[model samples]
Target chain A: MKPTSKFGVLILVAPAVFIYAFAVLLPFVGTIALSFARWNGFGTPEFAGFDNYIRAFHDTVFVSSFGHMLFYIATTLVVEVAMGLLLAGVISSGRFMGYPRVALFIPVMLPMVVIAVLWGAVFNPDFGAMNAFLSAIGREDWRQVWLGNPATALPAISLVSGWIFAGFYMAIFNAAFARLPQDVIESARLDGANERTLFWRIKVPMIRQVSSVAMLLCITGGIQGFDLFYVMTNGGPYNSTEVPTTYMVKAVFRDMEIGFGSSLSVILTIVGLVIAIFFRKWRSTRQEDVEY
Target chain B: MRIDPKKLRRLLVSVVMTMSVALTSACGSSSEEGDKTLRIAFGSNGSDGQKVWDQAAAKFEADNPGWKVEFQVQNDDLYQTVGLQNLLTSNNAPDVYFEWAGARLVNKVNAGYAADITDLVSSSGLDQQFAEGAFGTTSVDGKVYMVPFTSDVTNVIWYNKDMFAEKGLSAPTTWAEFLTLCEKLKSEGVTPLAVGNKDLWVAGNWIGHLISRSAGESVYDKVMSKQMPMNSPEFVKGLTYLTDLQKGGYVNASANTIPDNEGYNLFLQGSAAMLPIGSWLIGIAQEQAPDINLGWFNLPAIDGGAGSQESIMGVTTGYIVNAKSTKQDKAVEFLKDAFSADLVGAWNAAGFTVVAKSADAGTLDPVTQSMVDLLNSGASIVAPPDTGYDLKMADALNTAIAQVLDGVKTPQEALDEAQAKVETQ
Candidate 1:
């Protein structure tokens, strides 16, 4: 006797569903449950309905962290996504050698901890590369405490993040650009379209899906990053560079306030979901699937 | 080749079951067997200190046949903030662990993580080693929770003796004289002081000491203990002393930017004339800049101060046995043997100010002897806010100090904000 295809498919999918529930789903549920109770992570948890969420709204550090996160996201959009698109276009036009692309990608391949450390030295207030550069150029008046000042700390770390990730976005868009129909580009070129026009009109619009994906990646990655902010500033010079993740870690691990940290995490998860939904809708409204 | 449907179905089910069981297996405890093995945990104190500890453990293991010892060494920051609690909650909790002496230790005791060692301390020979009052800091409600390990005179003003001698300047004994010394240094093109508040605690401890010395320990205690608000005129008065240093350009420009280690680097390289730090500076300086002659003084007498001008800001740290350990007596024995008289001598030589009197048998460096002398001369001993009071409240007050020093907020505005933060919490 032969089994039905649907039955076979169900059997094959069962293991994956089981594993997902075990690894991802269970922890998420635990977090949600824990969010409703007060615990210091050692003793028994006391039930407190919505207290943690309410406290998060009132917590000055938690509230300000969101604003800093927004600032960080804006910088990533320009520094990572926009710069990446520019690099992909410049390299795809064949004006630069392949070595430049590889060189640009080197930071992305390097370990994040090493990069954070290197950049930390470059931004050290007493003796940093930035201040040195300013001094060398006789522009000493322009030097600032890049990581210690609230005004410049977030932007400084964002630049470091971009330095490490712009190449990643470039690689993605570069691959997308390569997959474009050659005939369409050739015909465009033959019709007296200049290189810039071809890049903007034919190749750019075709890779819209990849660029949209890249933008989303930057936003989510910006929201998720912890190592850079932690190593460079640890969210100080008075909490200027704190994001939700860093604050959450501080609360859960450092302060051992698990319920509050869990609530903050749930809030972050919801915000991520809402943005993803909004982004999908916006993208759907802006463009349709392009066929070769 | 066509596959048999029944066979394929069974194979899929088996694979799913196996993966599920294997993945879920991670949730079960990987607790080590605790019968014959001893696990001692601590925050890393540096290679020299850890080597002493490791040697002590070696002797302990040798004395006890058929037993093994393992150490869980972690960074100081990680250990204080989160590592100890994580270890305590695990199935393989350390039999013995390290902790500070105040609210931090009290927190562990309240959470049931600390073993009540009042009887143990008396019976373990620790009672006869240190002074009787030394155990007072490690107690909660008259019951001891841990064994005292090291005494750190947490904050002091260390001046370069050579520089002072060259300039014909002497260590200041009063707030006014301290100001004059700073002015003299600044006029001579030498930065007078260097402070690192990047972690907030360095400046936090300094501010706490200033408040205790200027406003009186009672007023400082009231704010930290929640009886009085931090925004009081007393608190502001204490903090202004620090701000004065900033405004005069007598401290390094990167006061709030550099870390404690880097700030010390500035002092070691002769970028500054003095450094306001704790006794730990002696160890690092001895290793990094041994040729430089070092001189120090306690917090100077502030004019119109209600508190003791000669108050010493300090904190103690020690090891605690886990309350839930299956081998509590064994852990205590390990501690006694590991921290034996000979080992105490070794630790004192390594520059750890072991409170045990037997540690005096070893040779003491001049700087270490001076530190001990300074501790002896204090009119009173006060704990730094972070160690003595609630950490969150300390953070608020310390962060306020950072903002004021950075010129981002005025003294009144910063303290008011800090007061509000503590109230809300």
Candidate 2:
């Protein structure tokens, strides 16, 4: 009966496993293979060995986009997680909590394409709402060509990313807060722990695992940012706002250099994986075993 | 009914398979004759040009029985980027598609994406109808790869006639005079040039013009063909000239950020006095700013330059067939009708210049009239660098131009970097 049960379980999972192999694994392997071949998305692919990877290392545009992604990830970590934790704490505190959760999460619910294009208009240097507000506030000098200047473009784009996904991280942290041991929180309050102390000292420490997960999600999302940059600036003003994903698109689709684009993709995947693993290891070392 | 377990399983599987087949067949039946459909893809040229294409598609379908023509109107940027590869590799590739004839077309031909149509043009006598040297870019190793349809002259400075008159300024004929005029306009608190460098290609147009004017036609041709490097002193001089314009307060403050449409619109609204744009602006101006008295002039010659002022920068955008298309003959037939006198007349009426000499140039609006005069007087026509180089190299050059405008790199440094990248490619 035990052997039969194992066989039944195998049969049940076979379809999903086959689909994963066909759809995900197959294309991934194909991409890796094509990364080493010189194919322009047409005709027969020529063997190019490590030439594509070699070229990528020397590519200034690729390097610039990679640097931009690092800046974006750093900002996302600070903005999304920090704002998310604050909102989650306030919402969980039951202060004006009657406001629906959907209101805060609305930006996350909107499609990324919609958010990017909306932000693009908002960031328009002339007649955009951002500059208009600055002028109305008598801060006209503070106004900038947000997505147009090479110096300001990446940071401006990062602000939009943080705005759109802060809500998503808030939802994640809210769920974690809801699952927190109410007995422990109440005990801390009874021990004369103020709301701030409880939130920072006890609640934060208790939800370390959840916060780690949220950070990991934000990191990966920032590293793979494409739609926002593609819609807003298209990595323009001399590729200042470029990221790994947008650069890959330009190489593969725009430039018709499949090998170079695929190589960039592989490098992006490796970078994401390494950062995620490092984060996991770092978080695990600080994690404490808790008993109910 | 009672049944064995294995038999019941087989019966269920068969029933599911039959249902799935029926569902798939229903969806596939509508587009089964998609092969018979002649798909023509073109860059979106406002609504008027789209209507012209639609009419041509209707006329072509009417002329040929048992054939359906589908018009795929795509945004220009998308068509040149992801859309191109997707169309070429798909089973239902466009039978006829728009293409810039030069290194871009050559890249497609080398990759076996473009069909060789040399014999077809010769047998049909289509070559005789086009102007001399019209097929130069479309030809690779003496074999025609595409057919020219639309032609344009770039680097034409479109200025507001009323503003020029109010300011007591005439179009300058030399680079020094142009600088003086710009300075004069600046002193009067007017933005001398409404530029949109955000699009990159808009800036690329100026670079191509300056190079052609500074380096001369012969030298520019050699540079484009890779016989000489792009980091040559002539190119550096051209880059310096462009940088000086930006530094001299001749261009708008928002030049780096504004989209091309907004910049050109500023000129139309009398906010800016001048616009250095291609011939296509004539049509747009005619539609959007009909009341504004618009005037155009060729890019001024550099002081003591080797190039003739008459060496104009231009390009011929045309239609090319898919190499793997099964209905090549039918597609060529559609192209013939698409380029017929009636269709060409419609395009010309819509403010386009057709390459076919027999095609009418319409009533010749003042702007178009100036363009025609300038093109006719050209000693040699040089295709824009963006057209003559592959997209990757062109992108590098565009970036270099932007960096120069941003004052991040000196002219020599930028050109040297761009030339280095091109050489490696």
Candidate 3:
């Protein structure tokens, strides 16, 4: 009976295991092997173990680009998560003015590329509504070279990205908030708890699991951000806005250094693994306060 | 009451097998290949050129029994790079494709991704058809890798002839004279140069010409190759020239934010006096505002500089065939026949200036013809900066110029940093 059960279990799991190995594991192993070679994607790869890594370490653009990614992640985490939580709390309380929650969440339904194009028009220096508003207040001096100046370009791009993704996070938080037990909130209210205390003591701790999951998603996506920057800047103004993904792409496709680009990809994967592991550990250590 | 485990398991297995079979069947069908079909892929904005090529291709197919050509147009977005890479890797590259003529093509040649057409050029006698400098761009290691199709004269300064006459200004012949003219135009409340520095490449053209003419040709090449530091006196002079123009209020106040079309629009409206751009601007001017009286001249040299007075930057658009193609012989024959004087003449008729040395090459629009004449009369023609530098160094220089314009770094600092970066590469 035990042998039959074991065989049954293996049969049930084998197909999924095969699919995962073929789709993910094999390509990953190939990438790792390719990272140690010198290839231009057309000729035979010459073995140059660790040379790609050594060169990557010395590359100033790649180093600076990684630093920029961290800076972007930091800013995005604070702004997006805070905005999402605040908006979710407000809508969940049923005291928000005017619009329905569904109406407020409509921006999340639009595609990111569409949103980017709309914002591109709005940010145009000459005929864009942004500069028009600046001039309207007789503060024409404040009109900025928003996307053109190096100092402001990255921040401006980040603002657009935050705006696009904040609503999606807000919807996630809203759904999570709806699943929280109402009895706990009611008990807190009966004990003369203010809104802040109720939120901190009851709601926040209850949603910790969801929050951690959301954070993990944000970190992974943030690390892999390419489209927004690619569309807006293409890492312009002296590669100030470059991310690792864009750098890897330029190296592989534009420069035709396939092996070097593969090495960069491996570095990116390692960085992602470190972050995921750290987050998992943190989540595990934080005990769940909710009892079913 | 529960069903037997083996029966349930078999039922699930059968369902999975059915789904797999269905998916495989869905993906298995192939479209019928037609014998007459000849696939041609080209970049966007080639409709006019495509019309001529389609006519020629149609003629060729008609002459040959049971043959037709199918044109496949693809936008030259970032995907072109990806598609080309994939094709080269798989040894399934297109028969003929339009490619930029410098480091962009050199990499393909170095990897043996492009077919050697030495026989095609010599046997077909096209080696002597194109101008001497026109073929230099597509040559790698003393072997010609592509056939020149169109000429891009980069240092031409296009001006509104009527606007210049109204402002009592003549085209300047020296850098100092140009600055004086700029100051005069600015004092009269007109933008002096309609430049779109937002694209970075537009700014690069100005910077490249100034550096080439200011420091002379060889120094420009050295700077581009990173042998000379970007912070060298020559580069600094180029940056200072642009910065001074900005400070003097000679350029559009929002030049960095205005796109190429908007700047060109301003020029067309006569709000700006001059536009330093390629000869391609004549086509744009005709398309956008045909009523505007436009004229072109070579970019002026620095006063008392080592550079010749008539030095201009030149580029070419050309064709390259796939090295691994089984039909390489047929492809070579097609290119040789298609790029003859007749086709070259058709291109010239469609506003392109062909480099073919045939006496009956063709004619362009009157204004464009004049610009081509001016290009023909130039004392020297310098290759664009990217043509001289390797891929990495070219990107580094282009990016550094943007940083300098945005004031993130001083001209010296930007050049020094770029130099440091490129040297390491």
DockQ of each two-chain model? 0.50, 0.45, 0.35
Clashes within 3 Å, all models in order: 0, 1, 1
The residue-level lDDT of candidate 2 at B44 comes to 83
Q: Which regions in candidate 1 have their CA more than 4 angstroms from the true location?
A: A1-19, A287-291, B1-38, B45-47, B54-70, B359-362
TM match of model 2 to true structure: 0.89
TM-scores, each model vs. reference: 0.92, 0.89, 0.87
Q: Model 3, stretches more than 4 Å misplaced?
A: A1-23, A97-100, A283-292, B1-45, B62-73, B78-80, B125-142, B226-229, B252-273, B321-329, B357-363
Tens-digit lDDT track for model 2 on A27-89?
A: 999999999999877778899999998888888778778889889899988788888899888
How good is chain A of candidate 3, measured by TM-score?
0.89
Give the Cα error of residue B52 in candidate 3, in Å: 1.8
Ranking of all predicted structures according to DockQ, beginning with the best and ending with the worst? 1, 2, 3
In Å, residue A160's CA in model 3 sits off its true spot by 1.8
- Fnat (0 to 1) per candidate: 0.54, 0.46, 0.41
Interface Cα RMSD, each model: 2.1, 3.4, 3.4
* TM-score, chain B, each candidate: 0.93, 0.87, 0.86
| Tens digit of per-residue lDDT, candidate 1, span B10-70 | 8887887887688678667465564788889989878878888888778878888988888
In the predicted model 3, the residue pairs found to clash are B129-B357
